[model samples]
Every structure is written in structure tokens, then in C-alpha cells.
Target: MTDQRANWTDEKDATWMTEMIYQVVVLGKRANSGFKKESWQAASSKLNIEHRVNYTKVQLKTRNAEMKKQYAQVSQMNSVLESQRSDACG
Candidate 1:
């Protein structure tokens, strides 16, 4: 059980986790913008095995929330930028 705080610093681990969560959702493990407990547990276990580090369901959930927030922010920024461009070009 190595330090999980260090696990996220590795880009490979972060990318793998993001992809794994997306795959889980695409596979229908997610419901109503949330994932089932077992789904999270499975993701955590798989990541731990693949990355050789310890991670918990809570960590995965937190990361998912953080990623969603970030994505929303980026989307909003892009939308605003597109609107500005439209106004300028109009």
C-alpha cells in the first residue's frame, strides 16, 4: 500500500484512471451522473492492480468529481470564447 498522494502525480496513473472511469460509465456502470459503489470499487481495484499502487473508491470518486468540474469550466470558457468570436465576426 504505497502512498496514494504520489500515485496521482504520475501522468500515466491519472490518464489510466480517467480512461477507466470513462470506460466504466460507457459500460453502463454509471447511473444518473453517479457510479455504483461496486463499480467504483472495481475501478479502484483494477487501477491498484494495473498501477501497483493503493487507491480507494473515495479517491476515484473525488477524482471524477474534480475532473467533471474542470471539464465544465473548460467547456464554459470555450463557449464564451466562441460567442465572442461570433460577435466580433458578426
Candidate 2:
């Protein structure tokens, strides 16, 4: 159990796992035609059958807003940490 815990807590291993998951999701989204399709014909065909385009658009916009907020928070965190490090070193 201690060995397993040590292995799981490895930073390099966690970073690799995070990168793998990100790559998988990025590739999967790229492979999805509905998200990438731009033609009215293709979009209409898919949305006409499913009536999900508007909802999906709304969801995407909401997600974009949330991501922006998260990015701002992370940037602020980095700024604070950098300032703290500078003050400590100085």
C-alpha cells in the first residue's frame, strides 16, 4: 500500500497522465464531425434530426465563459506566487 501510494503521488507520472488525458480528449473532439462541420447542409442535417445545435451552442458559450474565468483565476494565482517568491528572494 505504501509503495502504491508513493507511485501514485509521483509528479512526473501525474503530469504524463494529465497530458495523455488532454491529448485523448483533444483528438476525440477533433474527430467529431458535428463540432468541426461548418457547412449549412451538414449542420442542418445533423441539427434538424436532433434539434441540439442551439443547446450545444449555449453550452459551448457557457463553457467558454467558465474557462475564461478559470484562466483569470489561475493567472492571478501565478502573479501572486511570483510576487511572493520575489519578495522572499529579495
Candidate 3:
């Protein structure tokens, strides 16, 4: 049986994974469509080995998608807020 702690990814782990993914994208491993199989494997391996976790590629991919969704939502909200502020000032 796998340890629960090993399976669990906390906030810090998620942030670390995000940073790694950004680095991967910066290095041209990720394209507009998404990560390729080799890139996924590389990111999964790096996270498992360096972060001492046991996340599979699917898990990492799912988490990345979730983070992207959250980021987009936040960005949209910020844009709306800024627009409202401009209207109020104008």
C-alpha cells in the first residue's frame, strides 16, 4: 500500500510543482497545446525525485490544469475590478 502522505500534495508542493512547470515551459518543453509525453515524464520524474513525492504524470497534469483554471479565473476577476475602478474614477 502506498503511504497517504506520499500520495498527498500540500500547498507548498503544489507551488513548487507550478514553479517547475513554469521552468519547463520557459525551456520550451511545453507548447500552446500542452506538454508532450516526454515533457510530462521529465516533469513527473523531477517532482518525484526532487520533491520526495509519488505523483504520477496524470496527477501532475490534472493539478496543472486546475492551477491554470484558477489563474485564469483570478486574472479575469482582476481585470473586471480594474475596469470598475477606472469607471468610478472617470
Best by TM-score: 1
Clashing pairs in 3: none
The Cα error of candidate 1 at residue 83, in Å, is 0.5
TM-score of each: 0.74, 0.41, 0.70
The numbered model that scores best in lDDT is 1
The better-scoring model by lDDT among 2 and 3 is: 3
Candidate 2: minimum summed lDDT over ten consecutive residues — where?
1-10
Task: Report residue 32 deviation for candidate 1 (angstroms).
Answer: 3.2
Candidate 1 vs candidate 3: which has greater TM-score? 1
Distance (Å) between predicted and true CA of 82, model 1?
0.2
Q: Across residues 1-90, which tens digit of lDDT does each residue of candidate 1 receive? A: 433463465564565567566757577676676676667776777777777778766777677787789889999999999999999999
Each candidate's lDDT (Cα)? 0.71, 0.43, 0.69
Error of 2 at 86 (Å): 0.3
What stretches of model 2 exceed 4 Å from their correct place?
A: 1-55
Q: Rank the candidates by lDDT, best first.
A: 1, 3, 2
| Cα distance off (Å), candidate 3, residue 12 | 5.7
Give me the overall lDDT of model 2.
Answer: 0.43
**Residue 27 in candidate 3 has what lDDT?**
68
